[model samples]
Target: MRLRSLTLACSLTALTLGPVAHAAPHSGHRDATTAASAADKKPRPDDTIIAVVNSIPLTTRDVENRGKLFALSTGLPVSGELMDRLRPQIIRQLIDERLRTQEILSRHINTPPEQIAAAIAGIERRNGMPQNALRDRLAQDGVSLTTLIDQIRVQIGWVQVLRQELGARGRVSAKEIAQREDALKRQDGRTEYNLSEIFVKVEDPRHSEDELSFTNTIIQELRKGAPFPIVAAQFSQSQTALDGGSMGWVQEDELDPAVISMVKQMPVGAGAISNPIKVPGGFVIITVNGKRVIGHQPGHVITIRQAFLPFDAPLNPEHVTPQQQQTLQKAVKIAQTVNSCEAVAAINQQNGEKRPSDPGELQLERMNPQMRSLLEGLPLNKVSRPLVSTDGIDLIMVCSKKEKNFADRSPSEIADQLMNERVEQTARQLDSDLHRKAMIDMRIKLKGV
Candidate 1:
């Protein structure tokens, strides 16, 4: 069975890949007098050095590309004003990323090309795009594919660095697992929250105000319906940014005291975005996706294998092409003849495995009524009728079904959770050390930014 792990989150991190490169005057320029005189002499955004991390020069072009990336992720209409607004934060993030990148290279951490390809493929799959569609999308928007490749490379390498730093602590002990399990048992009937977060760090105490302003700006955009996961992937300082800021089910004691009170007061499923709340290292923006009573929900968990045939283009039922007709005919033959999940899996493999054959254990109660009803009566090992959609057809087979406590965590789950907590802690400490030791030079400064 494919279970959720840190790898999945790392793959999803590539979802932040975005569009275009732009040049605009922003909050400040380091050599203000020179910039002003140059602009007066010849007005345009030049490819001049904007900053330096160690000896590496960060140019106006570099910052502009990242600004455009942030714009694309928010799905907002790109404008000169928006680029200007995002400049300060984007510069700071890039500087920090440069520090991490340098550290990764110093340690000789190599991110295999296939790993990056897999992550990019994962991005397309999760975004509902066809294979290799990301490159096309980037091209259409004039955004360089290298922008995405570079960011994902660093993300993957940094994960490896964090794991190495964890040393033996990376492996959670049985005693620790038992203790967590006991704690869960003790908290039965208490409230558990399903939450997501975006953390914006303040690098220097003197720039706390600047960071807070940036946080407020992000909150404003999020409240207007910018996808939180995409924004988090682009900007959050927390390691959970790789998972689109998902915190899963967390309890009262697991959260910071400042955050606990705000989350407790927020209504679940209301899609409420919290105002910036101060924490130890940074400010946090939170949203409550749901809340559930611990140990109270019991439901059917099912495993299924599916075969998917993809359409060359979105299907037009009234104007079916010859290729589409043949695809449907092939699907019909498979549905009629395939008797086992293994057969369906084989069929999927021959079709290039456009989608995974096994989608893992699904919680039946969480599904919509139409889907839950369909699966509840589907006989085990039976090939389902072709489920046609605009872009693909699916044939599913239910392999197993069982009723269990949804709140309970398996030993492996507990272990992964502990490992994640440790990894996040290590990542933060290492990042701070990198910042403290790194030499950074700001070439531009903003007047009122």
Candidate 2:
């Protein structure tokens, strides 16, 4: 009996079946680690050329196939817009695969031929099919079984690499665990919200009967055909009214008691607009749009950015006005004006300080509550304003956001995840730093295509 690799076959990806039609014109991958399309490769016609990254090329066929899998896994519709947004993620995955495989080859990390054959045979047995059944499916799907095996091998190799490289970086103090336990018990957990808010400030809930009717009419329109965001933008008196009422995700306990009670009754995929609820300055036509309970899995969420700051590379410290250095309020303004990481780099360059090759990732929760507050409120993809940190002026950019659900630990899984997380950060930082140091040339050579 061919036992299937549950990790590979039962992934959320299996849901997205069928390939997408390849679009013409390939886009180039900008990263140095991008893979080249092997297209002239196997014979296929539905495929079109996409962009190239470095020497590597991505074909339309590859995107369609991978996109279908990614879409199915995420349960999101495969819209062109979403596809474009996912391009960076796909490219990152491709780069990771390429880097991993390249490392495998260099490190002589080869899987035994018997292991491969056995795995395939096991999968065939699980499905109660002949060995040729897989070959036949591959033939029909235009995907190779070998290709899947290679991907799995790369994933295994990456894990091996992490185990070796990040083994030493894993350690948690008793103090940290105690603090985590305390936070779990007393951090006010998060407030949950079952909110369908018109978002106007309320001076009174029962204004003119006309006001109530007008708001109810808007709610009805939303229930029928009008988009909530569109209406919220047109009528919401809140500061973010122009943003179309995208409150993003809200936890349940965060809502008013009445609002929370109403939302608890609403179903996940459906919601209803309640009669205008009384509030301060204005009446809220509570639309129980969606509700989620407040609480997060126990584990610290850290937002880290890393680049090794090189003390020997260069140095140019800012000539701060004595006036600016002494004052807290003045420094806050200076922090807000700093834009991207590139800006910070430029500032470092100007200060003549050698910036580290990889930035450091800071644990967000360790910061002052006020600092944590700012970071939490911002979108994940955005950078934070520099805060007057005890450690000097601290600026932050998020790398990957991970929440460890504290409850499901078998000891091994916890150690593995903790080790893996550190290893991932270490790998990124070390690779970036070492790649720069290993590079032979300082200048780019331009060539005509």
Candidate 3:
């Protein structure tokens, strides 16, 4: 998974920043003079410096804004108790971010401005807003756009640093790729999970309790609505953090025993490992994106054509409108008469249905249970009974169905797996080295926070 900017914002803000208080600016433009004036007026005592990472100061205002952002994003109440629990972790995260960014700067790794703009544009597009809409949203939330941009810059720059460390070794040789492919072939028919993870390292066994507490807080935020990817990006110790902690598809044998067990139990889509699973040096929180029975399952792809007959207004079953009844009759007649995909198209054209005749191909396994069952034994080119949904009555015709063995692995796929493993190992070592050598000064009293 390429860590999209939108997911990063969702993960960073939902659980850390609460709902935006101010109204969005209608113009979507930043007023520099107004911002400067507002800043000049902010000399509150709460804005005192909290901590300094190296020489960079982090302020109380920063913590407060992040707390609000988290609250807003996760829909969690920003109570004093919650802030007390979150303050330490937030400070740690910010300090680490500063360290990573400073390291990147020391190495002279420069992230292009265009890349940042593109990332912002992606965020705007994903949120269904116009260009520069993020600025307005941040302003409404009482956050500077620079805060988000700086975070993104750090993340992007860190990736460059890792890539530099990986160097030519990141590339998998043909022989190695072939070996991986062969190994995968041997493991055919085994279950594999498409997983993402956030690994919190415990440098010393004595600190395990603190790490566990921190991990639990992260899980709480995630369950509340924090984006898993952004959280992983910001805090995961593993190299895969560069890619939003995506581990791609891995068989049970390839993972830590605890992780394997967690993967087996986790349901696909949004369901995460409820508790942190302990491994060698740290605890891991995982999200199972999906799973498949390798080699045994077929990649079932289907193309279907649908005709939608929308009611003039929402249908009321108790008191149906004449227009709704007429539309339902027409849908039923089409379902009864339509035998082929072409005939379904003709019916849609005849009725002047505004919807597309071909809605495109859909993965069989990805469809809902009802839709999958309806199409399970459905004959090709045959129209089914009209399926009434909230939107409209749909007449579906299965245009094509193709099944291919999903287990036949490709060379590039195997190569990527190998590369990821190598990168992960290298990343951990580098992070440990950085921590050992860095001058980190914690000014805030974490014990009381």
Q: In terms of TM-score, which candidate is strongest?
A: 1
Query: How much is 7 displaced in model 2, in angstroms?
Result: 3.9
Which is the winner by lDDT between candidate 2 and candidate 3?
Answer: 3
Please provide, for model 2 over 324-383, each residue's C-alpha lDDT reduced to its tens digit, 9 standing for 90 to 100.
354434335545565455655554444323233134555454466876777667654344
lDDT of all predictions: 0.75, 0.44, 0.68
* Candidate 3 lDDT (Cα, 0 to 1): 0.68
- As for candidate 1, its clashing pairs are 27-446, 28-445, 28-446, 29-444, 29-445, 30-443, 30-444, 30-445
Please report the candidate that would top lDDT against the real structure. 1
Tens digit of per-residue lDDT, candidate 3, span 406-435: 656677677777777876787678767776
TM-score of 2: 0.35
Order the candidates by lDDT, highest first: 1, 3, 2
Please give the clash total of every predicted structure, in order: 8, 60, 14
Sort by TM-score, best first: 1, 3, 2
Task: Estimate the lDDT of model 1.
Answer: 0.75
Which is superior by lDDT, 1 or 2?
1
Worst 10 residues of 1 by lDDT: 22-31
Which of candidates 1 and 2 is the stronger one according to TM-score?
1
